[model samples]
Target: MTTLEKKGSDGGGSSSQEAAARRGPAGPGRFMGGQGTEKSKDFKGSGKRMLGLLKRERPLLIGVLSLGTFSVAASVAGPKLLGDATNLIVEGSLGKAFAGYSSKAEAVAAQHGKGKGKVADLLSSVDFVPGHGMDYSAIGTVLLWVLVVYLVALVFGVFQGRLAALAINRAVFRLRQDVEAKLSRLPLSYFDKQPRGEVLSRVTNDIDNIGQSMQQTLGQVVNSLLTIVGVLAMMFWISPLLALIALASVPVSVVVAAKMGKRAQPQFIAQWKTTGKLNAHIEEMYTGHALVKVFGRQKEAAEIFRQENEALYASSFKAQFISGIIQPAMMLVGNINYVLVAVVGGLRVASGALSIGDVQAFIQYSRQFSQPLSQVASMANLVQSGVASAERVFELLDAPEQTADPVTPERPDELHGRVAFEDVSFRYDPEKPLIDGLSLKVEPGHTVAIVGPTGAGKTTMVNLLMRFYEVSGGRITLDGVDISAMTREELRSGIGMVLQDTWLFGGTIADNIAYGADGATREQVIEAARAAHVDRFVRTLPDGYDTVLDDEGTGVSAGEKQLITIARAFLAQPSILVLDEATSSVDTRTEVLIQRAMARLRSGRTSFVIAHRLSTIRDADVILVMENGSIVEQGNHDELIAAQGAYHRLYQAQFAQAVAEVD
Candidate 1:
């Protein structure tokens, strides 16, 4: 049984003295470790960790890799083709000029000699002129080359587009799955300090940003790196001096990018933190909109949101604006180098130290080098954001929790439902023990009630018993064997709980009730609903149990929702039952109905009821009145009343409140 179960049992109420004994010097009991202390540090290993995450689905990763390579090849080849075609035009034009000169010389010699007659005949025809005025044949040849260039470019464009789409989509899917799994595996304490909005930002906004980064940057980074290397090789091959001039800006540009990246990475981290806070505030305001309106604090809420928004804006502006400076700075340096290379290369070509095509090719390579530098600067921003999100995500996955069950879980043939908490002592924080060195033995087929004040560690007790948190000191046993020795699934499968905060998925009522159970029969479901008094309400719905519900049961009444929860719990029909403030949130009439449903649920199973209403558990087999974190009194209702102790005082106070309400 969990700490929640131990404290919720209304029958096993403890006395004030026992509760005092359990309380720490500061206050009531609380987890084995104190609340708000579980820090997640999962993102520590960058290279190995990322690789491990990918190893599970090697085929999918390999496909992404292959497509990514294809995309890079296409992008680089497409640009190279454009430059190559320009050179072909230069070469083809030069060929036509020489051919025309030779043809003219032949025609002059023929006109002056015996072939003069044939030359005159050719000149008269004019249509037979192969190379004349401005080389029409060369123009025709260049037009054909243009058509081929366009056709090749179109093919590469299509290939690049398809490959990019396929590679990015696969990477995003895999990344999302890994993130989801990490979130699921994290301990519940991860949620204690953070706002729902912040958590949502990590899962939704942060992950989406990472996905977008991966999609755009992955190919660009790889292709740009390759392009830079290729261009440098070509430049050196053309003329070492011109190549040296063209790359004069390389070291300076690299130094600038490195310095900018160093400043930008920290700012990106700050920006994301600000984003999380802003998201948390927005989420809180939306969820509590009703309360804000009732209190007429809309302006106040808006002001709070404005503060968070301003912080987010400031952080983002600084980070992005600074990173944005990198591209233009790189362009300026490239432009200066471009002028230097052009002047040097032009002089060399004029002096016959270099060919015209060589100088032109060197100029092209210089421009090409600038492209990769520009790309690196741009993609650097995305990489920073991805790294930040990766860190936060890893933190979540690294949080500590109870040890996982062994490779092979110990599954019992049957559960006898005998529960015992011996010498149990626990604290949410080590400084404040919620349950002092306490012990209890619950025999099979008995109802146990735990009564306590608000901070008396009722829920904590259930948490411990359920092994949601490991015990700080003490042992819990089920049917004479230690529960710690059993697998979590095996231990929890035999227990059913209906908590006050009921949750329903976006599915038909029948589906939610059946949940993880395999193929629940219609009769069995309806029977369980009837037992829990939810069948009558289900019948009233237009779709009965088939009615689909939105998350949180937006369409259903609160009472009906509670009834459905009860029905679902009853359907499980575990060996032990736990009711955690089940009726506290309902109206008086619904409470009575639910109390009756609880009675039916308690018929055969060993039940733990955590109740606030004294009248409801008057017939409990055992009542343990708890205060702070200890049981101060334990006895039947009549016996505790006769003892004139804490339980008696609580009963009297409730009776007086009932009388006052009636008047």
Candidate 2:
């Protein structure tokens, strides 16, 4: 038996054996394996393109930058002003304490009279006079000015945050819209090759990451850069020697940050990739939970989940741990510089080369200088992750899109449903050709049934006819007009399809039925439902036609969902119809009803029916039996059965199986 058949049959196997089969011996790696953590080779180019997304909001960006600059400037100046106030207080207090001595010294010097002796020198040295006790008013005035500067800085900081938020939100909004539009332009094969969860991650998770990074990092980047420059200048103005000592630690901090960033980047990339894989696995498991339970593979599924979760945890922890070290490492360097400046500035003050207040301001500037450097280092990781996300989003935008028609061509005013494949050939891969130079023609209002074993390319033929995929070597025409000549929208407007896998969005039953016919009236939807034999079942529901369905149409049975899709196609009322195993999911009674409904739906349309149940298509005008992507037998039921070819053997086998089941 095949792996799937064995899984279905095994009910009481050893846990290990069942798990090995369900999850494969490779564990979760088989499901989680793919391109892992794609790092951008051209980071600068990606960063430029990422920034280009914000170009439309240049005015907002400029406003944010302006406000941020004002805030940093005020912040830088506040410390100096406070230092000045400190100086005033110190000088006033000292002068007040020496006031009496000054008066005594002047009197002694006058009494000595002779200008040459030790007493004269001592009196000169003791020259002191009493003055006003302290300048409390001047100190208060300076303090008041300092308060105003800080308050202004706070207000400007708020404005900068608001403006940056607006700009980032608007830019991200535009980016999301572009990605949505790009999805529609991409070829169907692109989706076939990619996981739905991975694609969704790009649209939701990746885009949000970019937005958050911008909002958090943009304002800080502006403030940090300005603070660094302003503080460095202030430090040099106070004491060039101390400034050089402070600047000495920057290169060491930079080297440490660079090394950590390099280590953390790949971890972050892996974190996001594994995050996508985990989501994909969860989606798959939840979607097939019923099957998993039916086969008693719940243990296996949980084990698989545990494995994937572990992988995600490992990557996430490494990424956070590596990036987390940058801040502390930078602060370590900053503290070393802080101590050096304090020691050196104190000595200089004792030597009278620098005043106490000037040394205090220099220390404040040194601390300020280290803060922005640390902030910038931390911002580096956030920016790196954002750039990685941007690269993914850009990769989606840069994927190969379906070719556009060279010129706009007008579609026929009315379609007659005549389709001809003139030597059509196609292959998913150029190296392995599937269909080779096949030709066929069908007149209007004829029904063609296609039957074959699995992998016979039955669905592929339908895809080609619908132009979901283009022919590689030949032309397919609709009513004597080449399909490629018209736009995809115009070409597909005349055809309707109903597949075995029914799809329904989250909405009321009436809305889903009316989806195919834009601006269709309520009465028209009911009429189409009746024609597809869905009106009876819908009327049985509590809300009737207004009943809401979930995304997966969970409340309804599979057969019911299939009927609703048929109703949708019926409402479309196209000139050509394609049905691929439309009744495969229904019971015998429902299948009969659906076959009758389908017959009515195909009354005046050219129809192609792909059915595994050969009994349903015995009355078709022609039955084409395909094998290995080419027609091997073609005739009506009686003719093909008498010929005793592939069709006869297929019919005979099915007949024997049915008889055996009855027995």
Candidate 3:
């Protein structure tokens, strides 16, 4: 049984003490300094790569840009048209006040009557207003045209938004698909060093951040930029002096935003890093909740979690606080510009150099100009965050993949299960070799038992055989063919493994049993379950073979889950079988049943049994004792006992322990 099972069954010390013993010292906060703390180094490169992803939908992007341009143009034209209507109304009203004329025609009529005008006198007198000089009809016509322009602008804006949204969604969809594909190609070594939660955050959180930024930032970026330019042109057309005064604030706002963005970028990077770290901690705590509770270490766990949470809060606050300064800073500059324009334009209007309507239009254009600038300034945080996330995603995409075979070789019609490891040397670290110059062979239909203490490199041998990790210095061959030459799928198809840690997906019992054998009939599944003795317990369940297993097979005991995996391997019917501590979790009776089933299952195939319980492999054809990184002794159980070697000592010790327990 595992340490956790022993601790829970025996009732250990206080939960905090148990947790501390299992976890050891905190290691000077090492968790905060590793891969979890890594930040994006090349923001520009990542941003460029992110933008490059959209190139695939160039036509859609072009359509979006064109629509955005037209929409902005129409919207800008509305203010200018409104200005023209205001100017006409003001001019007509002023005429009536100064000259007692209701319209231009009335003024012309009086002049013509005095003989200052010739033949046009009769027409002017007939068209003149009675009391006021203002022509309400002309002003109403101009206002109606302004309303039509505003309505058209609103329609274009709506269509532009729709098209932009569609384009962004399509681009983001393709981006997600590409990231998903990249994940499958990554090597196991990539996952081995990184925390699973951190990797998950990159896949789910980081990608989502990029998508959200694209959705809010893309269309607004294009529209805001266009609006700024269009608004500037209108301002210049109205009055150069006022335009100059408004433009003065542009440089100040730009400088302020640039400095603020620079300060905020590092904070944003730190924020994401801390966020990933916190997620990793939470995932770890959740997965090991049972162990924590069993040990009564909830307080310790909560303390550690609180520390991580505070770190995340600190980083997030700094990032947001720094970025927050941009808006108000830009607003202050905009307000100052507005005040200057009002004062200057007021002077020009009084001197008759500019009309009230032109002043009003210029003021509106100034606000429009400042609005886009403010938006762009505020968007700096989002863009930085997006780029940071993109960089992380790109890092995964750029990781080296497992080497592939140069050629796809055809599988032989028959595999005899003859295996050899020739002068093999392997190591996880280059400076320290774990398996050195090891040579071993197994004949067809022979059983080889491997017995070793923890870290004896026993599992490493199986790993090499299965090609989970390649041999460092030598080759492993199966049926006279180098295993590496064959495709991984083709080579692994003929080998069935039952690991100590049983893995069963969420599915019906029958479905899991049939997992190894595609297109397997119900009869085949039943036969395999019977062979593994899984049918004995499965039949007692309410739904029998149709019963659903939760993820991780939580509803079943460890022993039952192991039996299901055995049944799955049986259904595969591979040429070779490997049982690594297959009965480690079961009771004595269950182990007996499993041993019998495993024996039957291994009858005609070459088998490798890795066992800690010496009694389980006593009847094996040969037994190998491993110590450190090398095999020290090899023989059948009786032979090894007679020889009084390392195997004899191990078997004797276990036998004595079992006898003492019984006594």
Q: Write the per-residue lDDT of candidate 2 for residues 1-663, one digit (tens) a residue.
A: 000000110111122243345434534455455334445566789889988999999999999989988999999998899888777765565457545545655544554665544443433332234453567888899899999999999999999999999999999999999999999889766765566777888899999999998888989989999999989888888899999999999899999999998888877777777777677678878888999899888887787778778877887788788888999999999999999999999877765577667888999999999999999998877887888788888999999998886486867667998889899898766676777787888889999998988767787787787766788988898889888888887887888888877788899999888888888999999999998888999999999999999978978998898888888988998888888888888889878877898898899899999888998998888898988778899988999999999999999999999999999
Can you tell me which runs of candidate 2 are displaced by over 4 Å?
Answer: 1-40, 101-130
Per-residue lDDT of 419-513 in model 1, one digit per residue for the tens?
89999987655665667787888888888888877778777677677776678788988888788888887888788887766767789988777
How does candidate 3 fare on TM-score?
0.88
Off by over 4 Å in 3: 1-39, 99-134, 407-413
Looking at candidate 1, what is the lDDT of residue 510? 87
Candidate topping TM-score:
2
Per-candidate TM-scores read 0.82, 0.90, 0.88
Q: Which residue pairs in model 3 clash with each other?
A: 15-295, 101-133, 102-132, 102-133, 102-134, 103-133
The C-alpha lDDT values of all candidates are 0.69, 0.81, 0.79
Best by lDDT: 2
CA shift at 415, candidate 1, in angstroms? 1.4
Task: lDDT for model 3, please.
Answer: 0.79
